[model samples]
Target: MTDNKRFLLRRRPEGAPVETDFELVSDAIPAPPAGGFVLHNHFASLDPAQRGWMDDAPSYMPPIALDDPVRATTVGQVHASDHPDYAPGDWVMGLNAIEEYSVVVPDGFTAKVDVSAVDSPSRFLSAFGAVGLTAYFGLLEVAKPQPGETVLVSGAAGAVGSVVGQIAKIHGCRTVGIAGGPDKCARLVERYGYDAAVDYRGKSAEQLADAIREVTPDGANIVFENVGGTVFDAELMNLAKHARIVLCGLISEYNSETKHGARNLWQVLAQEATLHGYLISAYVDRFAEGGAQMAKWIASGEVVMDEDIQHGIDNAYPAFMRLFSGANTGKLILALD
Candidate 1:
């Protein structure tokens, strides 16, 4: 295809992102120059982190410039290459713009994929990609979950959270997941092996706290926090002494103008809890080790991978919105083919 279709950042969103926040533009695909390759993107990984990247604020990565194709991690086939390391028709993964085609340097985050190791190209963007890596390092390295500990995960049915709960279970921790609806909660218990599941939908703070207390009678020793709003507040109320709180992502406040400041932070002091906020990039050097171990668990049937994929790049906008609305059960991916 000579024409590349891409979604460009139109404006910074005030609250939840709307379609108007981005503009879909079609342009001619560019050829690779020397030491570069042309990628025909087949899958775009939609993440909550993308929302933060859209804003014109100081963050770990620079914000996407207005009218530029939005930044995303993509899995694609190398269409053409001037780089000796990559050849046409090779499947690769890397940081790329949200377009049908991207020009990439052989170095940096771009790497050839081992198709034999994964079920499909989309799987690389899911469990085997940043999602699983985030869960693995966050739980094992940061939380330091101990066997027989009570582990609670918020946003338990999401890409990262689902994996977090399962990894906690593998460590012999009693896992409790807090998801939005009853069905997702059921999936946490039935499919992901969480010992208990709490549905936070339509429930008051008191009710949510009661539900958490019921599952974690001795209090939570480790809390894998993904959604940071009332759900986090509820978890804070039930923290055990020296509780380890892995502050992964705050999806609840990503789009809002006013963030939900946790009123119960004092509990962290009283309970002698350790609250840690981390970026996945911090563990970059050890990603290979983490990915290898996750692959072993998946291969042995000890860990299950779940994905909610939306076909076509045309659906990328609405599909991305699903993450905030809790419409996706696991990893949310946009398949271009």
Candidate 2:
């Protein structure tokens, strides 16, 4: 039997999670049961949504229970299998626990990964994975942006936000990005094809609104909102008539005890704007359709993919914290091998 190391949830966090909230335990890796497969996980995804999964609250998915391995999306090679569809050497991606090894049934969010289609296995967790799919469906299906419209994206340097900005550009819309720090702001304009960028590092909501207005004189016709709190307020103040807001994530409020409700929601009523909150899982039936389009754009040089990767499972907690602190500029990944 192989010894497997896993991080188990030990306590529910009050605000931001600390490393002490999890307990690392080692045990023999379990063999696959009938029709199940064993995966030797190599990379695990670090996402802002993981914070919500830690809380014992009603959500789209069940909360992670104490003493259970921390839930995560992982890419790995199959080490053993009793399933007909899976083999020992196949590469796969699935929603598995954060551990060196996992035994899972080939159901739910599990699928074989075609490594030949992308640059690396990690891309399955980033641009080519949930991040890309979220951007695709959120912008095209939800927002339905058109040419000459102004598209505003918060957390624009992040995985999903960056992709949202680029996809908006592909649709011939004027793209504006809101991110922390000058470096990330510059990256949004220079690298991600954003027409303008607002640095929200030390700016007030009014300041952010003014900056956004300077770039988009007609106001933003479509808002791809990721970071909430003041960022949402800033964007709220700059919405065009009948603007569409595609709500993807609320990273800023994820770790806060008292979440900041959008103060300018009345703007939605005043401007006749539409706000739509979505879960990527809802579009699972059409994932292949979205993935194909994103892959085409990636190959044609229309979309640029970026990832921030850290090595070792021991650094998982710190790496996860980087998402909240804005230390990571793109999709944050933890490479176990």
Candidate 3:
């Protein structure tokens, strides 16, 4: 057997994760057990959710135990298998880890994929993967948007938020995005078909609220919030009567110790609005339904998704940090070579 490289969690993160928190170690590659397969991982999907799993806290999922590989969604080819459905060299996608190889079973999220459906296999990690699925289900199901309503999205340039804006537009809702910089804000309107884009960088809570109100004079009818903390607080202040707020992610507070959630949740009660906490896992059974429609949207040019792919498992730490640094424009992927 050869060596399988893995980036394991050496210690829990303090504030933001650093290189020292992880250790890259090589272990002997083992054969697949009964009803399981060995996957030769090609791409690992980097996400903000991984940061939440790093902490030893009670959450929607269990924390990543020390000395274990950092959990992530991966795409690869079947290297060896005992399962009847899997064959050597067959392409697959599943919830694995940041490793060159993984032992996989036919979990609900694991399945063989048709590589010809996408331009590249890594596209499965971006546009057609979990983030895209999150946008599809979270908006259409949880937010329950209406035509002609104004939809405001925070973290609008991100993987999930970017897709949310386009889906909102497809549903006939007027889309406005709130991103951090001028460049990202521009893409929200130009690339993602948002009606307007609000630059949230260097703005106070009141200032952000004023900006949002300027675009949406009557206030936003639907707020798809990805960034929590102050951004969420601002959105609360600018909600229209009976607005729907879909809480998909709290990216701003993901790395921080002192997590100050949306401070103005009372706005929900005041405006008689609905604030929904969205979890993509709830819609896992409907992935095929969402994936089919999303593929159609991509084929018709109604929706576009971007990816920033980086090479090598050695560069995992810096690559993961790009999510928080606002450096990556879209889905961040790490390819092991």
Candidate 4:
């Protein structure tokens, strides 16, 4: 490839992102400075969090600057190296950008991958990737659910939420997942092993709350919230005393110009619930441990991993739009091959 292809952020989006907000162009491929290496990306992870990073707002990470290739977590092989610890052809995964290559160092999160450790290199972008690790740490470590506790997961059909429900079940808790459509709801129960599933397609926040209450009669002891706005408000309506609400993502509000604060926050006070915002970066030091456990679960029949892989980096825009469109069935990954 002459230089490299990049999907650049042309402008900050007005609402939900459109293709014009980003432009694809060839640019000079950067050389690794001393101690840095170049990653020839093969697959990059698409996530709702990327939408949040598009804006010029304060967030956990800096906003993606205009004219820059969009930020993404990518898995690739070393193309060239200036670092002693890394070499050509070494497989690595890092929080790189949406481009053909990335220049990075051995930051806390970037590390080499053992391709033989998994069936496919893309597995590093799915089950043993960001979403899986997020679910593992968020549910098991953050929520700290006891046996018999009711665990309700929002966005339950998505990559992370599905894993959260399964892990909760493995730990002996009743799992209820709230997803967008009936098909996703069905998969949550039949495919992902949720105890029950709630469809939030046409339901209002109040109605969704009723649906959740019907399934979790005693109220949920833990609310693993991903979809915010109405879905999150609905979850607030039914909370067990001293419930733990893990704030993972706000998929419903990420694209909106007007961000809506939760209307049912009073339920938190009423139920004495504790809501903690979750960031996967917090547990980066222990990814090896989490990846090992997930590998074991996959080797057994305990955890089923799913990926909706789209071929070609040219399809990045449409592939990413799948998350908001509810078209992709599993973890969305863009293949640059």
TM-score of each: 0.98, 0.98, 0.98, 0.98
Q: Rate the local accuracy (lDDT) of all candidates.
A: 0.89, 0.91, 0.91, 0.92
* Model 2 agreement with the true structure over 1-337: per-residue lDDT tens digits: 3689898899998999988999888889889879899999989998988999999988988999999988999999998999999999899999998899989898779999999877889989987788889999999999998999999999999999999999998899999999999999899999999999889978899898888888888889999999999989989999999999999999999899898979899999999999999888889889888988888988998998899999888887888899999999889999987
What residue pairs are clashing in model 4?
none
Give candidate 2 misplaced runs (Cα > 4 Å).
none
Residue pair clashes in candidate 2: none
Q: By lDDT, highest first, what's the ranking?
A: 4, 3, 2, 1
Model 1 alpha-carbon drift over 4 Å, by segment: none
Candidate no. 3 TM-score = 0.98
Alpha-carbon deviation at 305 in model 3, angstroms:
0.7
Question: Across residues 90-135, which tens digit of lDDT does each residue of candidate 1 receive?
Answer: 9999999889999898656777888877788887888788899999
What is candidate 4's TM-score against the reference?
A: 0.98
> What total of clashing residue pairs does each candidate reach?
0, 0, 0, 0
Question: 7, model 1: CA deviation in Å?
Answer: 0.9
| Candidate 4 deviant stretches above 4 angstroms | none
